[model samples]
Target chain A: MTAGIGAAIVILALPAATAALLSVLPSYRLSAAINVASAFVTLLAAVSLLAAAPQPNAYILVDDLNVVFIVLNTFVGFTASVFSATYIAHEIESGRLTPTHLRFYHAMYQFLLLSMNLALIANNIGLMWVAIELATLTTVLMVGLYRTQEAIEAAWKYFILGSVGIALALFGTILVYMAARPVVGEGVQGMLWTSLIAHVPAFDPALLNLAFVFLLLGYGTKVGLAPLHAWLPDAHAEGPTPISAVLSGLLLNVALYAVLRFKLLLDANAFALAPGPLMATLGLISVVFAAFMLYRRRDVKRMFAYSSIEHMGVIVFAFGIGGPLANFAALLHMAMHSLTKSAIFYTVGQVAQVKGTQQIADIRGLTVTHPLLGWSLVFGVFAIVGLPPMGVFMSEFLIVSSTYERAPWLALLLGFGLLVALGALVLRLQGMAFGAPIGSRAPAKASALPIVAHFALVLIAGVYLPPPIVTWFQHVAQLLR
Target chain B: MKGLDFDVAHLLAGGLVLISFMLLYQNRLYALLNVFALQAVVLSLSVAWQAYVQDANHLYVTAAIAFAFKAVIIPLALHRIIAELGIQRDVENVVGVGPTMLAGLALVALSEVVMLRIASEADVLAQEDLAFALSVVLLGMLMMVVRRNAVSMVVGFMSLENGLILAAAGAKGMPLVVEISVAFSVLVALVVIGVFLFRISERFETVDAHALDRFRGDQR
Candidate 1:
């Protein structure tokens, strides 16, 4: 128990301390090292929680459910920081960024990590909302770091839309407090997730229903659900590539985590509308919509951004399907997607840097020019599109098959979306990977370790499921249920 | 005494919803800012009244923050930003007045139907406040949807935040109201700083979103 508390403190404190330190550290190399070191330490702290007991408190909690997220979040955060160090150095060399922006970038990156960690561990719903808000604000500044016209516009759009979503979420949270007040009887108790979930069955079902709708729309915006997803592609396409990787790999998952927590609340209430169908419908729509969107994406990052949406849709749909196997699949899919997508970005970042352009039409024939990166990109595309012998394939297959068993029509529709997305991805992959060599052929100087590391992990997870990890996922899946 | 407390809270909240409507019809940025300020003031009053009736002393802090930050500082700062940008004369109606106002009314009605139906078990005062708050929130969104200028969009966002503050205050004994308000204040401050940094006027040569749209990287 003591160890659990210590891990939680370290998880939250390390990033916070580093954020402050990075802000003042003028030496870019030192700050970059510190960022990676802190992220690594945080990841270690999160891993420690795997052995520690659950520590639920007024402000924080470390249970089977959140420990998985915290570990995954910090692991990706660590790798992204490693990738960021090299990537940003390249940016500085190219004059796209300066030392000063690098300082701010490092600081905001830590703050983003801190906020996401806080959100994952927060026991109080209000605290979780604040943490998510902080995450949004930090990333908004980072998204606009380039100060380019496109970057600024993307940041502004993200800020405005994100604020509206957050405000609605607050209103929903207040309504939740109102609903819980009579039974939970006031102040902190009403807002505590521990208490709220315990008392929710006795609370007003109608209020829970209304709150769920608002919460869905609110956090749904953050999750890049269709119709509320206008800002997402732009933000991803314009931001620094490391931020793009983090956005796809970790931030989207955090928002979906919030939605799942609320869905748990609705699920506990017997009289409330089953939140499943609503999530399923929206999830299905996002899958089909973003799948079609993938074809038209002119920019590589934006194309992957749409793929992130499609993958998120599948995960949400799996969770929405709401059986042990489906939830288990969702959890696995989320982890695999995070690793695979970020690996793709690492390769894409190198590809863009080497080619001196982000436009898909401007660059082609990667395999001829840079064999390592070309092949890595190919591997990433194959992994992400759910090709054989990759982790994503395992999760997607589980989701589709499990969904098929329960609701065949939904399964068919999901299968159709997946196929469409797969087709678009393969089409893009062929053009970018196998065609005649085009554009500048500068060799990439950044380390390929992060990409190789991520893809290897995904590859191993695909081929075999270690029994212990399987048990962990199954345990968390039960908790989610 | 209890009846009077409810009536006073109801009056202030209803007034906030009314100013939200006032915010909706203003084509001029200055008028919209003023109306948003008015709404914030009303929101502060409603929150203070809730503090009094519930005797939740922490709420007073939220009320003060709402008054000082939203009602006074935010508007004055935005006024200076507009004057410096020289877009004070900009008229923004992405959807003209009649249709926008009509849409605003429909949103208010929709909120009333939604809130009242779901909040049946809550006390009458809280229920009514929530309905008014929801209307205010919806109208603010409508304002954002219809405004093309960035300054007006900021005002619209502030008004929407005002609605959230109202809802948070009305949910009697809601914890974290003060912290949430402070968090929001920080958000608004950052947004104000964003406006300054973007130098919306100098960068795009106008604060019009259309200018921003033209440079959308994806299109190229």
Candidate 2:
């Protein structure tokens, strides 16, 4: 028990300590190194949770639901920081960011990691809301780090929309507490997740239904769901690429995890309205909408941002299906998408640095210019587009097959959206990678180790499922249901 | 005592919604700031009243924070920001006041119907307070939508936040931590917006959010 508590404390505290240290460190290289080191240490702590889970307390809890997320969050955070170390150096050399900006960037990176970890572990509903809000504010700061008009605009839009989402969420949370108060009584116990779930069946179903709507819209905005996803593409296009990676890879998952937590509460209540239909509707709309939007994107990062929305839509839809198999598939898809998308961003970062632009029209012939970088982009694109051998393909297959048995029309629609996105991605990839070189042929000074490591894990997961991992996912899926 | 609590909470919450309407029509930046300040003051009074009636001491701290930060400090900060940026004192609304007022009235009606219908079992006092709170929230969102000026948008967001605090206070037994954190988050948002105002004006010589849209060249 002591060891488990210590591990949890280390996981929560190390990133924050790193953030403070990085803020004061004048040397950019040293801060970057420390950022990576801190992330690695946090990852170790998170992995330790698998051995001995902590008891659920008033403030923080570790359950089957969050442990999977904790491990994935820290792992990607560690790799993204490693990718950032090299990626940020190129930005400095190109005079896009000064050392001061890098200091802020490094610090905010760890701060973001810390806030996300806190959000995942928080057992109190209000505490989770506060932590997620902190994550939003930190990302807003980092998004505007460039101080360019476009970057500022993106950051401002994100701020306004994100705050509105958060405020609505707060209202929903208060309503939940009110709903619980009559039965559970007053004080902190009324707002505790464990207590709420335990007593949900007795709570007023109408109030719970109303609260779920607000929570869905509120956190859905952060999750980059369609109709609330306007801030997403611009933020990705304008900010430093590393922040974009973390936003797509980790932040969206955290928000969706919050939604799933609420969904579980609603599902446990026999009287409350089923939350699955609403989730499925929103998810399908996002998938279709993002697929169509992908064709019109002029910036490379913006295209991928839309793709992130589409994949999140699928994951939400699977969880909405709510059977054990679908829930497990959703969990697997979430892990697969995070790994694949971050790896893709790492490659895109290198390509942008080498070619000196983010415009899809300006760059071409990657294969001839830099073979190693080119093939990696090819591999990432293939993997992300759900090629047969990739983990994403495996997860996508599970989702579609499972959905077909229950709702064939929905599955058809999903498959169509996926195909449309596939076409758009392939068309863009061919133009960028196969034609004659049009931009700088200079070699990119990037560490390919992170990308290679991510793709390898993804590849291995696709080919063969380890026994222990499958059992763990099954346990989590049961908890989710 | 029960009747007095219900009437007072209803009146104060209604005042917040009314001030939110006042916020919508104020084309002058200084006037908008003044209206926002008034709204925050009303919010603090309402919260304090809840604290007194519920005998919840922690709510007193929330009331104090609302009075000190939202009512005074934020408006003063925005006043300074406006003066420094030399943002045009009179700003054009994306939609005219007559139409905006009509929309606001419709929103208030919608909230009343929605809240009353959904929260039928709640006590009369809580139900009325929630209805008014929802109106304030909806109106704040309307203000954000119709105003093109960055400063006005910030005011709109703060007003929305005020609505949330009112709701939290009315809900019996909400923890002190939530109230305090909400206050702190709004302050941090103000600081970040203040800095961005200077940055935006420095870059474009205008604080109009439309200028930002023009730069992006695409609209969602």
lDDT of 2 by residue, A1-481 (tens): 7788899999889988999999999999999899999999999999999999888889889998899999999999999999999999989988999999999999999999999999999898888888888898889888888888788878877877888888888888888887888889888988899899999999988889989999999999999889899888878878888889999999999999999999998998898999999999999999999999989876888889999999999999999987888998999999999999999999998999989878888779999998878888888888888998989999999999999999999999999999999999988998888798898999889899999999999999999989999999988888877
Model 1 over residues A1-481: C-alpha lDDT tens digits? 8888998999999999999999999989999999999999999999999999456989898878888899999999999999999888989999999999999999999999999999999999999999999999999999999999789988988998999988888888888898899899978999999999998999899998888899999999999988788889989988999999999999999999999999999999999999999998989999999999898777898899999999999998899999899999999999999999999999999999988888887778998999999999999999999998999999999999999899999999999999999999999889899888889988997889999999999999999989999999998898777
Judged by lDDT, which candidate is best?
A: 1
Write down the C-alpha DockQ for each prediction. 0.70, 0.46
Candidate lDDT values, in order: 0.90, 0.87
* Clash-forming residue pairs, model 2: none
Which of the numbered candidates is closest to the native, going by highest TM-score? 1
Model 1, C-alpha of A153: deviation from truth (Å): 0.6
Candidate 2 regions with alpha-carbon error over 4 angstroms: B176-198, B201-220
Alpha carbon deviation, residue A118, candidate 1 (Å) = 0.2
lDDT of 1 at B95: 89
DockQ of 2: 0.46
TM-score, per-candidate, Cα-based: 0.98, 0.97
